[model samples]
Target: MNQAGMISTSVSTTTMISGSHLFNISGHSITKELPAGKCIMSSPFVVGGYQWAIMYYPNGLNSYDQPGIAFTLELQSEGSGVEARLEFCLVDSHGRPSDIHKASSFCEFGYVSCNRGFSGFITHEELEESWYLRNDSFVVKCTVGILDSSVVEASGCGTPGNANDTHQAEHLPPSDLHEQLRKLLESGEGADVEFNVDGQIFSAHRCILAARSPVFHAQFFGPIGEKNFHNIEVEDMEAVVFKVLLQYLYTDVLPDLNEFGSIQIKETSASAIMAQHLLAAADRYSIERLKMICEEKLLGTISIDTVATTLALAEQHGCGRLNEACIEFLSRGGNLKEVMDTDGFGHLMLSCPSMFNLILANINDPNVLRDLVIRFSKTSIKS
Candidate 1:
């Protein structure tokens, strides 16, 4: 906040020009003093589809009466014949551009021509008094116009004399199917099946499950269909996980992580455990979409303790996306040493020794890859 009781900024953001590019030169001060003919130029910055630079004279022109430095926002692109409209100004410490000193001029030049902004930008005495110069520097803002209203792209696929500017309707949320199934699942009016997982029974509609999952369809009504089975015994997953899986089958949306009583979700315990089991169940049920969805959820909540285990699951289930994410996260190299101490990491090494090769292969950058190997070696000795 400034002395005024309102919002504020250090350099005023460009807003006046529309359809034009603006470039700002911050810390625009030259350390070395220059002679009468010398000038310091800023590095080239892109604006309005062209390269640009700001040239500033440190000392005033003694031959002329101008006291401070003169600034020029010029085209830096070589071998380009262009006549560009330029607007330049000095911005105050409080981010207010000086409208009084701002200049608008046309620069016509190529690689050889003298293409720059208007002259006599500001005086030294004026700069010291004005709030524009703060911390021995100021901001020079420039806007270069690119096009007029007529430069739009040509459209119409041979339907002559008709503009045919019809736009497709915006995508609506996937609410209809999700809501209908959720309602059906909750009401249990058409529910025809019950799943008993870990001694907990979850009632679901056989038709709905079959429509959503091919495995369910096969199990309930396939070539060797066990159509008469009312309650099916589900294996290898906790009741809560099975319940959540049923919810996903009913609705396309994943429930909030917070809904599952997740405390410290980033660690190896319950948070990703749900997702891990969901991935396994999705794979078993041949629900490719659900498998990918679970893989993504597991990736987001991964921590040092869970990364190795997640990677192992990713490999086992042929989840290429999650597998890549795990390697990339571990390749940061700083966290590898700590991750190594976890029992999951031990299990990963024993079960899938090739994951180390995968991690090493993904670390293309020499610096981070080196750090990762060094950390792994050190951690291995300690472990």
Candidate 2:
């Protein structure tokens, strides 16, 4: 067994292999300030084929335990008799990992017992004086090495079956093909076609563009579609949005939205307006995965200010998941009336009038429903 900086174990006679589980303690610096608890815990995180959690006691576990904080590493993984070697650390804020507390000896643990590292690992006085606690967050890094019996059975660490894929993914860097195609797209090398969105021109390789998008495939090659020997003028899209759409087509990624100067969505607004436009672009192009990604981003951005317009956008693009997310968010009783007061609310009400029933049913006051009904009736009569 190796201890000082490495942990290892062989549960069976065949071979020995190891994997690491990093249990990061984020948002835990304030746990020390909270009063009167012997055991406070970090949220459970899954890694290395196990579920693990961090337990910290503000008060010492007992009279002999240190007055500061203590830590416990728990293995919540299923199945028994599995062997694991563990190391624990209190990561330093000073950027020097050597300045922090780490266990010198690797300890073995399972569901039967937890390895409580050195008690009074750092006294309350010692830590309070240290920079380890910053911005009410500190990290406790735990590395667990699990013994794999399959290694011995295979004669060596040679990956068997689908693990070959996993091993390849782990060892291989990003494929050169991805970078080459990205460079080709950026350099406009061998670009066979162009799309002019309003006045801006986007040059693309026909084969690559067609390979990535069915819409592009159809427009460039399929029956009943036009052949673009020259620049095809694109309509109903901003040039900036089209560039990103084409970028996704080339690279299967959305460049960090922060890098784009044209995106108007701010941090507070949940950044949906650009996603909405992207969603429409994706829908227009009939790109399912891109549409789903845009829908997911839009779903996260839904709130009182954006839900109405988002719902309408979802409806326009036929994003059922996003459409449902918007209606469901508004249906929650927390603040429907206030949301209805926004300008987008009338647009959604007029567009998705049937949803008003669900909104009326879920809101606290029924009078709102009556008033809207009366308003709609009067508008109908006048029309």
Candidate 3:
């Protein structure tokens, strides 16, 4: 695609000149006198394979007090095989040719040719190439490619990517997060498993397992033993938990979970039950691994009533965050009214009256309060 276009800039000056003496002597001509402060000149040229219009203005004079000229050149190149080149000369008030000098370094030159595409060259190079006048700033352009196949060949093809492929490859499917999690979870157990994290892999089972959990325990204790086992004042809790959980997977007998419960049968013992509940809660909330470790710790300490009591206690201790979780389990729709009416109610209210209030406020009828008091009184007397 051979297309041509032109860019033009205008210069203004405080230096004044009579209209008649400001004679332009290029193949182009001044078309119009602008307002009191300006004049307009146009150049006939081609750029990027099409004809373009150019213009110039006056600045303060050289040492001769003549009108110093500035210029704006615009070129538009379109269509194939378009080219132009032209020169400009200036005549001073004395009717003699003025001495020409190169313009400042900040002056810029750019050209767009049909075959060469768009390019910028130094103004000095532009002036030298076209034999432009240096006495005053002038824009010189001419139809350049008309006679020379060499210039066209030298310009090269303007369209890009002619020699290289431009198509992109299709995207592939994403890696699975579950698979990654499973791999990480199974890497090692407490005190023996080795794994890498953040580019550092420690061979010690204790260190690697510790990365998974706050509790650390030996691997032989089985999965249940691994629950609830946390290192005392551990340097890093996450590392400890990670290692403990890993160990639980490898050996179902978790020493930490075992430590909390009796050595006999590992069935649903108090500690084992508690551990299971904690594990279930943790898993339910998507922190299953952490829950496992906690369950292991509380293995012998959990029961339905105990969980309810803990809910109240957790609330009283300002562990309201845990209280919400505890309440979720306790609100499973049972004869909770009778349970609450016992002496346990006094303890419950004493521990967490706010939680009691929350429960009371949710009940449908206020008349139940008297029955509740009577029941509480009877349970208290019996206790």
C-alpha TM-scores of all predictions: 0.49, 0.56, 0.26
Leading candidate by TM-score: 2
Provide the lDDT at 150 for model 2. Answer: 51
Query: Residue 80 deviation, candidate 1, in Å?
Result: 19
Across 329-382, the per-residue lDDT of candidate 2 in tens digits comes to 554444566676677877776776766665564444466566657755654455
Task: Report clash pairs, candidate 1.
Answer: 12-95
- Rank candidates by lDDT, best first: 1, 2, 3
lDDT of each: 0.66, 0.65, 0.38
lDDT by residue (27-48, candidate 3, tens digit) is 2223212222243545454333
What's the lDDT for candidate 2? 0.65
Candidate 3 residue 77 Cα shift, in angstroms, is: 58
Model 2 C-alpha RMSD to native: 14.3
Query: Can you tell me which runs of candidate 1 are displaced by over 4 Å?
Result: 1-177, 262-269, 360-383
Model 1: lDDT to the true structure:
0.66
